[model samples]
Target: MTVTQVALIKMPAGNEYFNLLTKAGIVFDYIALMWLLALTNGVLSPLFPIAYLVVMHATIYWRTKGAILSSISLTAGYSTIFAVQAQFDFNTTFVFILNLVFIWIIGVFGSLIVIRERKHLKQKEIFHELMFTDYLTGLYNHRHFQEQLRIMTRARQNFLLVMGDIDHFKQINDQFGHLIGDEILKNLGGIFRDLAEDYDAQAFRYGGEEFAFLLPSIEETRQISFFDDLYGRLSSEKFSKECLSVTMSFGIASSKSGILPDKLLGYADQLLYSAKANGKNQVKFESRYTYYYSKAKEEIAASKQ
Candidate 1:
């Protein structure tokens, strides 16, 4: 199966169905354990209730609060059985209360373990977000872009890699100061996010004043209008408190078979330079012939060696 199909299959079911199934399984398992203990109690020692406490530990997977609730219910059910066995004897009644205390201790320990597990999971999520997200603009960082490129390359999927750099960014930073430059970057990040969403594309903040876009399965004819719309939106967008107009140069390269991610990005970067050289605030695209030419060059070099 394809990676996309596998991903869809592995995705979690709805929360409501999961919760119901889990709770029912927990309840049924506990009930079965209780019945087995009762049936075997006569042949076993009276101290067998301790086995019930050990069984309660399984509830730990339900998390801290859920485990505590399960523990309470278990205590109530086990205590009822113990009280019946005590038969009004002082010594037996004392032992029953002692066993109950031990059960609560087990419950408390299980809850503590669950709490720690929860905290660890939360930390992992936070670390993952920090790793993949840009601090300045909250966009997907370059590291994530590398990962996306790797996945797409492995799958042999075709996509357009569009690189954009703000026009005259250094001048803007020099004239308006770094803080205003930062604000402009933040605003551009938002603009890219909106445009990417509208166009069904993935966007990233490549670094500094640079950004990247991945447009999957976009047709050659459609790409022109898409870039035109993107150019229009960016040109019309205001920046700084001065409401100054801002523009960006874009370079786009489409994936071809046998092309590596780094090479594609480099080609796009070259196109970006071309856009800036010709005049800023324009879009430069790769010719399909370029890939064949590069491939032919590689073949020629390999044959000569």
Candidate 2:
């Protein structure tokens, strides 16, 4: 197979890595300890090398499962050394047993610390999700939307702001009860999720009955077909056993509007209001030049007068 295909095939199963770098560090530490043991053989205190051995195994235990392997390998290495020493003097056997016990104790304590650290990290992830996710629609919440706007503004990336709201959402709630209205919201959220994944966009549930999208790196010319497809899907969606159809109104503003993120949101929101005012189930989109041109013409007329 081609190199590219082989690389793809070898992709890790999960989003996390095994931390091969940490493993490499462990290997280096093992080699350094071996070198120290060789240099100090039958000269200095054997306890000095034992201290280094405990530290090396403890370091690996702090992060991963390397502790057990380190413990086993160190035990076997010391056993071999003591066995040779026993040919001359058997007194080194006591130190061998002590070495095994001390290294394992350090490994166990390091494993405990690693467990606690992982638990704390998992809790933080859960809290972050709760803080930034909308419970009802399972989409990014308004806080996350605001944060994303700030990030996009700082990065100076081009994006299109699309505001959408269900048409007569309150009427649907009043007519069919809030449950059906909720189902409609969920269905629309699902549609938005799929669209966002397909188009490399971010979708947010701005508030009750309102949703927003950030279409990153998309050109104005690419929006018309997307809006067309979106409207088609929304209009044809049936949310209830009665096969009730729902519609939504959208307003889109391009990055060419040259407005701040907050202003982009406000402008798109205003256009959405205009859609609702003119007629429901329609989209209203405008470039920055349209409003700028109108304002300039009005100023020119006023100056002439």
Candidate 3:
């Protein structure tokens, strides 16, 4: 207990015995936090020092920001306790001043720690940069697509999975050569990027001839309007080489209806294959994901009848 000569601060309890006990309890809490900070040899030993700092910091911080109450309390409480423990064998004044210097020094040290951690994180990210970026198209590869799909699924955000394959892409590659095919893919990648931006979606190159998308928080109306704009854009978009027109068939499935990523992917793939089977350049959204299209179809039929 720090039996300090506190002048004007009177105890709140009415009974004298309870006042002593209350003072003792406050001192015990102060002593516990102080003991953790007092050890000089191994300050963060057993990782208790950070815990003490957190407890005291929270107490003082809820009082006021930029107020040095925790630091002040820790220094004063621990120094007084240490002086008592040392039985005046220690120079308490010098020790208190030394602790103050270190507390200020640790503030600078904390800033350095933050800077170092950020730099290390950036370096780590550079090493982990995705290697499977499609140079011609600016989209992720098949591996990246699967990895990202798993990530989004685990995050449990309402998402839409779409499979897009260029209509007659191989024919374009064969007839115009790989250079023109590359240009076409880049042009289409630009369109996909634009589409993803407008809808807060992500695009991935699923394979040499296919692309994928994960569109987050897409409701039925936004979903239909999204694809409608996409289909319209690709149908009318002009490529740089000889004013060529690019078109793609997209198959989409949504997570709002509780479709898992793998099954949703399969659904979109099936729709894409069916589109190829039916003829190219059109979209098919299946798997209870027909909210917008179904409503549109109903409205149109009602209007006609």
Candidate 4:
């Protein structure tokens, strides 16, 4: 019975079938105990109170309706044993009635405790979400970003850190307004969020107009393909009438063994600066290679002509 209780507690919640099976097991245990009491001709009657413990355990996962049903089932089973034994004396009858009342009371009280515990768990979840989430962009906040980076660094896990900044963001805000700029930022955040989901990566808003992506180590070709997709999507996004389009510059650095988190971030930041210096709306990597979108190259060539 102890092992059964432990297994039930360890089972993940919200599965109706599993819960039903556990409840059935508890009922079977009660029936078996009652059978023993009858076979012994009331010699084991003193052990009947163990039924209360079973009912109490059921109430943990069963909530109010389940608890009440479990109590009723136990009472019916016990009454059958009482009838079989023909124990109709005043003392036995009073003790049986008292036991039934205590079972109901314990079931109701145990359900109440379960409800309180659920509420506490929900509160904790909400608190954790607020702490780790960025309110404006809905990405992970900078604090979470730093913490995750530190964890990966401590574990010496290989990854790619890509730092991105919106190109000419201040100019856009000055030309249009902060509201339009904010909308642009929110849209870009959504794009990053989708990309993260697709790539099984983490994205964060690393302060104003800057974002970061932590991607698992992959082949160079795949990394370039990811950057190409990102650049294409950003170039196609349409903002307000005043602001036709926007672009971002990125700097990517691969993780190495024995490297500190701060140094990795700094190297990525430097690469980002290099992208901006060469021309906005491009990506620079630690390999000292600069990547440009095909359309961007054509546009640059056209402007030169």
Q: What is the C-alpha lDDT of each candidate?
A: 0.72, 0.70, 0.63, 0.84
Candidate 4 Cα RMSD (Å): 7.4
lDDT of 4 by residue, 246-277 (tens): 98899999999999999999999999999999
Candidate that would win on TM-score: 4
lDDT of 1: 0.72
TM-score of 1: 0.62
User: Which runs of model 1 end up more than 4 angstroms from their true locations?
Assistant: 1-107, 232-236, 287-305
Query: What's the lDDT for residue 155 in model 3?
Result: 73
CA shift at 25, candidate 4, in angstroms?
15
**Order by TM-score, highest first:** 4, 2, 1, 3
- Model 3 per-residue lDDT tens digits across residues 1-305: 34432421444446566545643444456556556555642222243345344333333323222124445565566556555555343455565456556654443444345456667988886555557566677776677788888777777767778888887878887878888877777887888888888887888878776888888865555666776677667767777564387667778776644457778688788988777667667667774343232255454455457
In the order shown, what is each candidate's alpha-carbon RMSD? 10.3, 9.6, 14.5, 7.4
Model 4: lDDT of residue 108: 83
Q: Cα deviation in Å at residue 9, candidate 4?
A: 19
**Candidates sorted on lDDT, descending:** 4, 1, 2, 3
Which residues of candidate 2, in runs, are more than 4 Å off? 1-95, 232-238, 242-244, 256-258, 287-305
Better of 2 and 4 by lDDT: 4
Better of 1 and 3 by lDDT: 1
**Model 1: residue 57 alpha-carbon error in angstroms:** 14
* Reference-based TM-score, model 2: 0.64
lDDT minimum window of 10 residues, candidate 4: 295-304
